[model samples]
Target chain A: MSNITSQRSAPFVVAQIRQDFPILKLKVNDKPLIYLDNAASSQMPQQVIQRLVDYQTNEHANINRGVHYLSETATLRFEEARGKVQRFINAAETREIIFTSGCTESINLVMHGYGRKFIQAGDEIILTVLEHHSNIVPWQMLAEEKGAIIRVVPINDAGELLIDEYQKLFNPRTKFVAISHVSNSLGTVNPIREMIKFAHGHKVPVLVDGAQAVPHMSVDVQDLDCDFYAFSGHKLGGPTGIGILYGKASLLEAMQPFKGGGDMIAVVSFAKTTYNHIPHKFEAGTPPIAAAIGLGAAIDYLLQIGMVAIAEHEHQLLEYATAQITKLAGVTIIGRAKNKVAVISFVVADIHPHDVGTLLNLDGIAVRTGHHCTQPLMHRLGLSATSRASFAMYNTFAEVDALVAGIVAVQQVFAGSM
Target chain B: MSNYKDLYQEVILDHNKKPRNYGQIEKATHQAAGHNPLCGDHLQIALELNQDLICAIGFSGESCAICKASASMMTVAVKNKTRADAEALIQEFLALAKGQLNAIDLIQIGRLAVFAGISQLPTRVKCAILPWHTLHAALNSGAETSTEAEHDPMRTTIGGA
Candidate 1:
């Protein structure tokens, strides 16, 4: 193993990694902040934050369609960030990267542009039960408008997708297959490469929602051979209000523009309007310039640290967390897939998830408690909500220990009263 | 991070553990359901009234500690109080939750005062207020005066005086 990988594998060194995130320096309720809610959004690194500050102070101007010095500088920085994203996801070309508000808007762009045009009446779009609302709702809207059929692939008790069932859902009418690369509610890391191949066999395009996956693992769109990949910047140590939608160049050119405004149009007249080319055709109006720059910095930071090392570190943390949390009484870990991300959701017996969350907060530990924007997934699991603790590279094994200790405290408090 | 440890006082924990009137009341006079979709906390509160006073209050649903305990304490606090008084108490609770009042007024509500700590958590404020919101809906739905049982609080009739 590499030195970083070896160092990460050691639990003690993992404990020390907590210092990297500046937010961990503060105290909550006189206790050190033990943030375990990385799946929702990650805390910004000093580097990422500084990048945003530098952009606002030094290079703040609208990108593209400009010739002045500041505009030229801003445009160069913006395109450089796009190039960074192109490398981060291993897309074939820089033109494949289109920036948007976040994962929701990214998915909506595809649904409205590509899905609206291709998905006709009686056409079918297949998705899994593990999708967040962002993935489910946009498709539902498109299906309803186009009179397309929506098919959901069910998950097993362990939260892993039933590949056989997913295949069964595939038909000649299956125009698209939308799936989350890693489930946000459960930590199940889907076999996306095989899934992409399966969809392509049916001649159907696939959109992989990588909001949870991109943060934890190395993603290569070329390797997966997915038609489109989407992820939120905020979930990956970058600023909010920025996300990327990577599509095949040909497919992007074929699709219509999702929104019509400045920057996305090449020419506008009362007589005729001509849309811009490729990526800019999809991005509308004053885009999140500073956020895009911050995302670039975040990508740089992750590349420097190496995603493979981060994945390995998270794997060790997941193993250790699973072992410790499962040992606690009345605590049932939600998902147990063979391959998964670092997100873990669980319910303490007879205790509502919010209660578990509040009690844990008393100890200065932050966790998400709810349906995790996947109500259908919760319904599939016969649960209303589950408390979730997702990990990032900056998280420490000591934070996991603190989580265990906090959960134990909840169990003790509720157990005595009951 | 504030010195709000008293918000999780033993009485609140006790009420949360062995919540009184914590089952569905058959043929309830007034029923209302409240939900905090953000956290997925759902609560259904049923009130049995005699004349203008609340005879009994029972609630059945699931939620977190702050919500469940608040509901449980609410049942005990509002029993036998006039509808107007109950409404006033709800308003007081809302103000306290918004940090407009001190912990002393919250302490007046006994164990329910433990939720004063939740006021510090902006996100969790909704979870603690689920029961109050449901009660408000139930009362406004003509459940206060009508002796007839209602099926779903979400669909309850309103504006009947």
Candidate 2:
């Protein structure tokens, strides 16, 4: 129960929760800010910001190195943060959660740590058209190095993944599968649970790219039964440069250490080095300690409001935004999947997305324009790029109205050009 | 929204709708493609050079309105001009786009001055300068050029090109 749904059942409320994000009050170009680019990066709440300030003010220390009191406090808080992440995603163990720079590095970790060790030549790695470049490129690099083939799962015209086709892709050659829990560009909520089960049947492990899914809905990695789960913090209203990789403990133990450095080794000498445990073995350097703590605070903030509440509000916004945009002439909604999050990708006829983005900025309505790093999906949809408006828990119905008004103003500016 | 009109203006939109010299120039002496990787804006500039003069110029590709309009105006402005004059114009237009233009440079930009507002939109400076980069690349016989400021060969070899 996030704040929105909590309003229906209990004392917590969405309006009070909205005040937690100070950027909501910002005025861009003399107009009230209407931020719909949450899918790219959501606005950080003051709670997370204050947590960073407090941590740096009181407990700033390099973790696990010193015998000092501050080092012990920082180390305790950092491990507590890891525990928070473990519980947030319903991870099986604390050691299963490895912190990286972001979701990209998390996937790359698997590509290096797991894929390199086990995957051999002639193996086929299954991917979907809905994957971001972050998910695709690392696998491509791994495939190139290992002489593996990448098999793709296509999407229908409505931008929904073809589940039947995905099932058909598996054979003895299929070694692994990586699919997005949600499509960033189209807002399509993929059936990852079923897909993971299908992969498991083939004895192939599945890695769900939860970068776009975790913020909008409750994610239970154990329930999905995915071998690995990855997500970014910034997209979850936390600080940038921090993300999580949830791997099955056994799988993590079996894989090679992705990087070797301080705090990641049990014993280190020039002669031979024995690596540390699961999480630390992958975290090579002095990780983003502050960001991981902020992400913990962000998780607290979301849990306080409740995810069900957040998803409910986002769905309402999606419905209103979709209905309004559909009524406009020459404006096409790109993704109309039966199941989707609050993202809306659309194109204004004969006008490039850059033009639309520029005009919307003048109206203080910020939406992401271009391929959204899912160029292959854009190509599959027969578009070079489309403007996207994504919602977060803090977003309001008025903000959706502002977005519509902004689009109308953009249309008026280029009225007869088409 | 008026801020957009200042950037998009009536003429820029018209040029985008029906770009002048909007095709490959047959028997072109030199040609080069330009790309703004940030937004996937791409276009090629082709010119038929007769000794030192650009006899005919044309451009073709897929890009945003700003890039299409900039390319359209560039072909119109540089067609039939001497090689030196065209190169000078390219520098002036690029300077104008980056908002580094002096009053003299602004005047030199002429009708192309409509794109001057791009400097305020840092994300769009490349869109306005892409055509100029491609034109410069075409004259110098480069295979391609990017809108990235560091890749400007003219900045290092202005007179040589």
Which number leads on TM-score? 2
Would you list the clashing residue pairs of candidate 2?
A1-A306, A2-A305, A2-A306, A2-A309, A3-A305, A5-A309
lDDT of 2 by residue, A1-418 (tens): 1222343444446688778899989988888888899999999999999999999999989888779999999999999999999988888789999999999989999999999999999999999998999999999999999999999999899999999999999899999999999999999999898898889988999999999998989888888899999999999999999999999999999999888788889998889999998788888878899999999999888887777878888898899999999988889999999899999999998889989998888888899998999988888877888999999887888887888878887777676543
Evaluated at residue A261, the lDDT of candidate 2 is 83
The superposed Cα distance between candidate 1 and the true structure at residue A173, in angstroms, equals 1.8
User: In candidate 2, how many Å is residue B5 off?
Assistant: 3.3
Shift of residue A74 alpha carbon in model 1, Å: 0.9
The C-alpha local distance difference test score for the whole of candidate 2 amounts to 0.87
lDDT of 1 at A27: 85
lDDT per residue as tens, model 1, A94-195: 999999999999999999999988889999999999999999999999988989999999999999999999999987788899999999999999999999
Q: Model 1: clashing residue pairs?
A: A29-B1, A355-B64, A355-B65
In model 2, the Cα lDDT at residue A246 comes to 97
List runs of model 1 lying over 4 Å from the truth.
A1-20, B1-4, B24-27, B103-111, B142-161
Clashes of 2: 6
Off by over 4 Å in 2: A1-12, A416-418, B1-4, B24-27, B103-107, B148-161
Quantify all predictions' global Cα lDDT against the true fold: 0.83, 0.87
